[model samples]
Target: MKIAVLGTGGGARAHIAKLAALGHEVHVGTRDPQATLARTAPDMMGNAPFGQWLADHPGVALHPFGDAAARGELVINGIDGRNAVAALSAVADRLAGKTLIDYAVPYRYDPDLEHPWPTPWGVMPAMEPVDTDSLGEQIQRALPATAVVKSFVTQEQTTVVDPASVAGGDHTMFVAGDDADAKRQTTDLLTAYGWRDVLDLGPLVCARGMEMYAHLHSAIGFGLGQQFGGHFGIKVMR
Candidate 1:
């Protein structure tokens, strides 16, 4: 399948590399393809520059966001939490009539929080639209014609693409969306990614809990004393 991954960050790279290894045509999206290629320094997360990464992976193609989205039969959104809605909304026309699997958490990093969780790299970012609203719902509202499924937000992207590496793949994965078919497609993609315990949390509104898991995910990581999400997984026991 021709897949478009919209973003050039670490999470986006995870999907791009996996999809390409899975023999799918992967197109990456960014605000400016040329500028993205020109990046010399690492990203905020300290992931290597996209150009350096791109040089190693020659099969992938990079384009402006809309153009990349226009070329995909399936679109995986890995855009940063803060900018996902606006960036994707600008390409809404290109995404119409397709299933969009969104794995972005809307995070508002406030350095001035009275009490903030600290990570080795920086303070943990706070979730935005947290309690009542979620980034998934926000994106769905922005692109009514597109079927948006919220998923892969509860864990690190590394664990997402390679679930079996943890606990022999006994863990559970969750997907929530308003459209049933879209959720099914997302599940199919997850199956391709080797997920066996995919739980449909029912409706996009359930995404609130999924997005809220961000904090707990961090808490678990901090508890484990490992940076970068602690390389763990959660299983929903029946």
Candidate 2:
């Protein structure tokens, strides 16, 4: 399976490395392949440069956003939260009819907020379309031809690709989307990633709850004594 991951961030790298290790052809998408490779410093979150990470993982192909999407049978939108819609909209044709597993949250960082929630990284970013709409629905609206599944947002990047790291993978993962087939595809991938429980939260609208949980997710991290982010899991007890 050729999978397209549209971001060079740490979270994206987690998926990229795991996919490659799973024997799939991983096509990593970036704004500019050359610029990404030219980076000598760490990213905003202090993750190593893409070039350095790529060096350790061989045989994974790197290409511009559209090219990577075109090469993939399944597409993963790991683009920056704020820019995901615009970047993905530009490659609409390439992603049409494909199962797009969107894990990006629309986080709006405002420094001049009257009341700011501070975090180890600076300020806790406010999420857009959080209550009424969600990034998943926005992406689905932008690409009507695409089957978009809302997933991986309720997870930390590390635990997303490796669920067993926490409580032996007893926790639950959730998927919400209008297309049943798309949700199934995403659940299949989660199974590949060793997720034991993946709940179908029904339609895409449920993503509002998932996206809003981002704030609480961070708070839980803080409570756990994680300076920046925490590695934990949420289990829905029956």
Count of residue pairs whose backbone atoms collide, per candidate: 0, 0
- Report the C-alpha lDDT of model 1 over 1-238, residue by residue, as the tens digit: 9999999989899999999999999999999988988989999889999999999999899999999999999999999889999999999999999999999988887657888877876888888898889999999999999999999998789889999989998899999999999999999999999999999999999989999998889888878987766588999999
Q: List the residue pairs that clash in candidate 2.
A: none
Instruction: Estimate the TM-score for candidate 2.
Output: 0.98
Error of 1 at 40 (Å): 0.8
For all predicted structures, in order, the TM-scores are 0.97, 0.98
**For this target, which candidate reaches the highest lDDT against the unseen true structure?**
2
Point out where model 1 deviates above 4 Å: none
> What lDDT is obtained when candidate 2 is compared to the true structure?
0.93
